[model samples]
Target: MKKGSATVAQLSEFDEIIDVRSPAEFADDHIPGAVNMPVLDDAQRARVGTIYKQVSPFEARRIGGALVAENLARHLHAHFQDKPKHWRPLVYCWRGGQRSGAFVTWLRMVGWDACQLEGGYKNFRRMVIDALAQQPATLDFRIIGGATGSAKTRILEALAAAGAQVLDLEGLASHKGSVLGALPGVAQPTQKKFETALHAVLSRFSPDRPVYVEAESRKIGRVHLPTELMEAMRGSPCFAIDASREARIEFLLRDYAYLGDDVADLQRKLGCLNRIISNETLARWQDYAAVHDLPALFTELVDQHYDPLYKRSQNSNYVRFGDAIHVSTDDLSPSGIIAIADAILAKTPVRADAR
Candidate 1:
């Protein structure tokens, strides 16, 4: 790598990664761990673009240059005040263009070893895409299969806590992988950002060690899983959690207790099932929510909707579903889930090749 520029692969060599793109751009997707320090913020970028299109390119640059200088000065006095003289940072903009180039030049003039990303976020994005396409197949995966409310995610969390390799798809997507899975006050990451998160996690995992993940449809909320990963997961061996109906209902009532806080919101979510569930049935479910009769609502949903859908999808999609090792559990509490995770870890000893 040159002293003034670096590639995506050289990300670790820097003391800090700085993205000089606008805040909106940074929010949509960015290199993992990169800090946002916009040379031209959203409004300023829009103003400059308008000028470039309507007035002249030269005029836009003249105005944008002043704004960049002002923002950089503010950043130096405020954000960068504690930085040491030897701090080495990698700076990038959308396309490794004027914004990051100007920022890097100013930093180098300040006697800091600041390099521009060779192709900026565009290059990094390409690397993420390529990694997502190829990396998932390299790992050994174990699917956690179960009906809705089976606490599969909890089991995966327990496995991770017990020092096992686990890929949490739902957590990464910020959705629970159902119509009612949207988390309160939490927005899901953009599809690109989700893919970036996936790449980051997969890069850290050891391929020889079994990576436990929950079974999911191709689409989780709004973002879709990579085709490569979906294919890899379908072909991998599975462990089915055969929790009893009562246990599942109890688990769900506890897990989805948040839904009971706002009866109107809960009814609105239930209204989404109007197409599949009859009007009378939907009205009855809404009434249950209105009355806070969660047990009845969950029981009907499990027996009528989630369980049937899960059965069909698992049988049709997962090649190894029938052959899955059935792990029975009547308890879905934290302690019980931990016990299950421990049993799984003990049963599947790490292979010598994994080490």
Candidate 2:
């Protein structure tokens, strides 16, 4: 790993990295693959921000600087003190400002090889947005879409495992693109980071290979897909993943087990629907959900919201991924999915190039 100031290009060699920005700022956006390890907790950051606004930038820096130093020492002694010798860390704060610089300085003093990112997360975000907005001429895609419980992602994974050139969009995205899509106890990468992650995956696969992705809107939670990729996806051909409502409900429940009695999170994810569904109706649904009315809730959501959107998007963007292989509830198992994929593969040429 390279030591000292780390340029953005140089930072790419690492398999992973740490983000020192406040989690709130990070939740808004951050570098993909960078895990949050905030130097200052939320309260401390708020306190510092207040100081900066009310007092002077100088006073805020003086006070915040001391606090940061203490946090760094604690971090080193506790986490990095006895780890690998001279480890290189890609350090960053918002806009590559004082916070990351402070952390990198402390790392060097402790005999570690620390490289701070130039222009920090902001520059990285710009890079992702630029790449996404103006994707090179060669990029191409094939979208995988089905109703809410169609297991499109599992099929994509199976295809990848089977030596097909594939792009696991959800994996890179840290989202499943639904009310229950978020992984348990893990935060999502920033929107720009998500685009970067998508770009990284897309760049690796041959443009001629039918890159498979789920049909997703421009936004995943707070993150937005890059315009280029979104356009690519919209135009990309698709294989319709079909499944019975019963099977879909089971799959969706298992996938969303993490929410575990947190109906509020579900409502929040549902967004505008909460406004549409009367409180009494919601309470009834929640009660049903509590009593294993999962299929009903899932079916209602698909019928009411997901299905309508999917149909509209598919009807409008049918030109991109031109083929459709419908999957069934009987195809829920791994072999079943593979069979469907193989059946689709058999009908089409292997190296079907896209634009």
The best candidate by TM-score is 1
Clashes of 1: 0
* Model 1 lDDT, residue 332, Cα: 95
RMSD of 1: 2.0
Candidate achieving the largest lDDT: 1
Clashing pairs in 2: 235-320, 236-320, 236-321, 237-320, 237-321, 237-322, 238-321
| Candidate 2 lDDT trough over 10 residues, lowest sum | 346-355
Q: If scored against the real structure, what TM-score would every candidate get?
A: 0.97, 0.73
Score candidate 2 by lDDT.
Answer: 0.71
Error of 2 at 244 (Å): 6.3
Model 1 CA deviation exceeding 4 Å by range: 349-355
**Candidate 2 local Cα displacement, residue 197, angstroms:** 3.8
List where candidate 2 sits over 4 angstroms from the true fold.
Answer: 1-4, 13-18, 26-41, 83-87, 106-113, 134-137, 170-193, 242-312, 320-330
lDDT of 1 by residue, 1-355 (tens): 6669999999999999999999999999999999999999999999999999999999999999999999999899888878999999999999899999999999999989999999899999999999999998799988899999889999999999999999999999999998889899899999989999999999999977899999999999999999999999998888889999999999999999999898998999899889998999999999999999999999999999999999888978888888887889999999999988887777664652221
